[model samples]
Target: MKLSSADIARYVASDISDGSYVNLGIGMPMLVSDYIPEEREFILHTENGMLGMGPAAAEGEEDWDIVNAGKQAVSILQGGSYFHHADSFAMIRGGHIDISILGAYEVAANGDIANWLIPGPRPPAVGGAMDLVAGAKQVWVMLSSHVSKNGEPKVVESCALPLTGVGCVNRIYSDLAIIDITADGPLVTAMMEGLKREDLQAKTGAILNFVPKCEILKSFKNEA
Candidate 1:
């Protein structure tokens, strides 16, 4: 079964460290904030200048002053601090962030990520993605295993879209499996239940390596 947005977030949350600082990118990646284990005490950072932020605000509990880089309503933890964009970028660029979770369009076998734009004449939006990818200690992506409309592969041998950052992605959290990009190519670290090695390979644009110690993502299904 395909993992829901919440399921993916929960899985990503599990991999992150308890006291680590993370920058959650917009779109699907932002929802990860909602699933972080309460005891983990991970600090959430937003490019808009909020550190120690909380999940999306409850209905009627929204706060205009508190928001993420996406401009969505957010909440602040007790010790959360709001600062200027300059300082925020410093935190992002100076390598203070431990892990960054982002949504992606395509990821190359060499760990190249293309998430900012597709080839077309449209208004471009390249926010702090480039900085996060380049500056973070580890970069993790959250996306569907295949293109939503055509069922084409998103984890490709090479990215066809505009590059966000090359050789930056460490791991990918997709609906069908958890893949790790290595010097050898895309490694199958974990896959969803009932999906054989061949099944994941057929849908992939590049090769999929099976590490004997690879994990089967059966526990994530238990979250349902």
Candidate 2:
């Protein structure tokens, strides 16, 4: 079965180390904050002038003024502080963040990302993606295993869309697999249950190697 957005989010939360500062990009990346353990000490950052962000606000609990970079309602943890947008971006561009989880359109085998645009007449917003990729200690992409519309691969030998950053991605969390873009090439590090190497290969435009013992990923992130 395909992983739900929440399930994919739980998987992303597993890669986050305790006490790390993380920026959750818009879309599914934002859901990860909800799955992270309260004891884990993760400080969620948003490009929109909020730091130490909490989970999405409960219905009727939303402070319309309090939101993430995507303008989605959110809560703030104890000791969480608000700052100027310039200062917030300073924290990002200054490289103070530990990891940035972003949703991707296409990621190349060499760790290049193409997420901001698809090279058409669609009105585009660049947002903070480029800065996040450049300054974060590690950039992890979160997306589906394949492009759903055409059944084309999202993980490709080369990105077909415009580039976000050159060789910036470290890891990818997809619906079917977890991959690491190591120096040698893109490595399929983990996959969902009942999925085979052949199935993953058939969907990917990039090459895949079965590590003989590729670890299957699970989500106990919500557990204490």
RMSD for all candidates, in order, please: 1.7, 2.6
* Runs with alpha carbons beyond 4 Å of true place in candidate 1: 219-224
Model 2, TM vs. native: 0.91
Cα lDDT, model 2, residue 16:
87
Which residue pairs clash in candidate 1? none
lDDT of 1 by residue, 1-224 (tens): 77777788888998888989999888888777777787888899998998898878999998888888889898888888989999998988899999999988899999999999886788898989999999998999998455546888899999999899999999998888888889999998888878888988988898988889777765455543
Please provide, for model 2 over 1-224, each residue's C-alpha lDDT reduced to its tens digit, 9 standing for 90 to 100.
56667778888887788999999888778788777866688899988887789877899888899988888788898989999978988888898999999999899999999999976788987989999999899999989545556798999999889999999999988888888999888888788778878988888889876566887765444557
TM-score each candidate.
Answer: 0.93, 0.91
TM-score quality measure for candidate 1: 0.93
The local distance difference test score of each candidate is 0.87, 0.85
Query: Candidate 1 overall Cα lDDT vs. reference?
Result: 0.87
Q: How many pairs in model 1 have backbone atoms within 3 A of each other, for residues 3 or more apart or on separate chains, i.e. clashes? A: 0
Measured by TM-score, the strongest candidate is: 1
What's the distance in Å from true for residue 224, model 2?
16
What's the true lDDT of residue 126 in model 1?
92
